[model samples]
Target: MSHGPTPSDVAAVYLQQGPYAQGHDPHGHGHAEARGHGAGGPAPKRVIVGYGFWIFLLSDIVMFSGFFAAYAVLAHATAGGPTGRELFDLKRVGIETACLLASSFTCGLGYVAALQRKQLQTQFWMFVTGLLGLVFVILEVLEFYEMIVKGAGPGRSAFLSAFFALVGCHGLHVTIGGLWLATMMAQIWVKGFKPQIMRRLLCFNLFWHALDIIWVALFTIVYLLGAGA
Candidate 1:
């Protein structure tokens, strides 16, 4: 087999192509060398990040699927506690859902602001989005507290357990999202929305949008369908 370039030969190649094109195997590993020599055209770091994030999302989806199956299994085991039809207030849930949806929209606008380098506007919108998320979580917490106080706790029924399991997980995410937004806002004030911050924003966007998708399941599976049947 033609073993191609030694270090000296690769140095000649590097000299010919210049530093940008001649990918230095910073890892000093054979795979790095193979990548540079391979027909794959020297894969960029962004490609690695993209592929990694994709696997992360897929694993998250698998985890969520387990929750969904649990919910399905426990959907009808209301025990003696208040059932979905008896307990769910669609008008109120609708309001909370809309608030969360609107927060996601404002988050998108905030991303645009960061892209344009409008630091103040970006922080302002991020805070607004965070506040909306906070409001959503507060409402959910209020609902749960009121129910548990009235003895409709998760311990009262498998249905309630699954309900809290699915929807409460979403509420927890919203709370974390609020904190993340607040942190990002502070980082913007201190460091400005640089490329690294922009990457973070993209990751948060994925999280925010995933929350919205999960809420769709809560709305349909836990609320609309449950209430109807």
Candidate 2:
């Protein structure tokens, strides 16, 4: 004759039921651990890296926000010195903005090439992006030199100080980004789109895009508005 269900078999059936249908584990233990209420599983390395980088990016943005606030407060404090409308050159600013924006596009293309494992295309696009960034930086340097020669340097007044601090900070970031692109190109050449290298590339793309966004804000608030004022 067939035997009745044993105690262990009954316990298995209970566990097979929905989690909420049972108040606790059949073993008289809390269901928290089984229900993923305890420590989470170890995150993947990619996820960990991405999360850390996002925190870094957010902190960087906070710093920029502080700078923006300072610049806004001091934008009109020229103290009888050259104003933004008198000192700024819209034609050059337009060209610099164009180059930087174009570089962002090429940077995206390079990232796509990297994901496809196209080493040559990646290198080509990254090189183009770096060249464009370089051009933007050179234009910025020329603008600074022009201002300095015209007695409108950062030390000239509070307005100049804030303008230099804000614009110079962005220029510095672009310079770093160009260096990062070069490093990525070299790494891809030697390592061939390895997972870790791809992660770095992804981070670089985020960083470069962030710079683009910041530049847009700077252009709008500092350049366009300042010029109008």
Candidate 3:
């Protein structure tokens, strides 16, 4: 029946002690309100943005889960059309995967440069990241073109439709990400490593890395396994 210390009591104590010590969260709100009320002046912009972006990433992953499920269920519904093994080119897929993974690495380096406030290094690394992403997108488009030319387009069969839906969705994200990278590059050029621009760069890094992770799964499930079959 003990309510323990009231928030006012805690606040008074926090004020007396000058904010809770590190590794201390008295009210179990993870020191968020404590910091806010104790002269912390709201959570840092990076933390807020990072948390929101994580939620967005989780929602994106859920959407991709649905696509993966659909592809699994319908991968076999070729209806006399060509199968994945016959249609997928593993060598090309491998190259695409390599490009994406490399872009992820460069994006990480760009993030480091942003943190260090290295203008030229950040721009150079981000430029490489964007170029690699562009290559990946181009390869994806070329693959789609080849598939369509071979009479295995999305309209040709349920399997092809599901394949295109899943793969094309990811490719669309990459395309959007590439554009975002361009925008960030412009922002960095104009604004330098301002807090807001750096926050944006961090979000872009997360988004690009998430896309890379999704592509890995896609390459494994849709490309590798499909190739084996």
Candidate 4:
């Protein structure tokens, strides 16, 4: 008579076909640990940092959305004051747009240099980016000053109030981004592309790029449309 399989045979079969056979640890770890601890443990530092920064960016977009909606609603509420068609200067605004868009390109180049670990190249591009950003901010401030001198200040009418609230918020973001870019440049100079520093540079790249996207919307809606109106 044929006997049943022995205990040793059973154990051998289990070892060949069980969870351990698929690289599961007997101590309860899974194959994910071998693949960089992505399942049971924390994600990679780069992933975690990037995800967090994206969340912050989304929240910022939401805030800007609120301002845009307010501007749209009050866009025609000039209350017989100077309307956008009268106050807007498309020429200056066009120059500002060019500077900001150019800064975004330089910012991308800096990020690529950072990835390649070229310190001098990264610094050079970032310096150019910051310079362009500074020019944009100066132009915006001068625009505001000119508007105010012409008595089209925010307090003059509901339309002007909404205009300043929307455009000023974006200008403030650009100023903050410029400050952030300076900080990142200083850190790269001192730290020399450490993991944490690279992560920060990536965040700065995203932040700068997002600002460019926002400025495009602002330029089309506020400057172009306003001047045409």
RMSD for all candidates, in order, please: 6.5, 5.5, 7.0, 5.4
Over 6-114, each residue of candidate 3 has an lDDT whose tens digit, in order, gives 8887787677665546544666455543343346655687989999999999999999999999999998899998999898888899999999999999999999988
Q: Give the Å error, residue 112, model 1.
A: 1.0
- Give one digit per residue, the lDDT tens place, for model 2 in 40-136: 4456688788888989999999999999999999999999998999988999999999998999999999999988999899999999999999999
Please provide, for model 1 over 1-229, each residue's C-alpha lDDT reduced to its tens digit, 9 standing for 90 to 100. Answer: 8565678876775677554454455323333334444666656655566567767877876777888899999988987668888888888889889998998899999988989999888988888898889888988998899889989888999989988888887788788888887888888889887767777777777788788888877788889988887
Please give the ranking of all candidate structures by lDDT, highest first, separated by commas.
Answer: 3, 2, 4, 1
Q: Write down the TM-score for model 1.
A: 0.81
What are the Cα lDDT values of the candidates?
0.80, 0.89, 0.90, 0.88
Question: Largest lDDT belongs to which candidate?
Answer: 3
Better model by TM-score: candidate 1 vs candidate 2: 2
Kindly indicate the candidate among 3 and 4 with the higher lDDT. Answer: 3
Model 4 segments beyond 4 Å from truth?
1-23, 27-42
- Clash list (residue pairs), candidate 2: none
TM for every model, in the order presented, reads 0.81, 0.83, 0.84, 0.85
Ranking of models by TM-score: 4, 3, 2, 1
Model 1: colliding residue pairs? none
Model 3 misplacement above 4 A: 1-42
Return model 4's CA RMSD, one decimal.
5.4
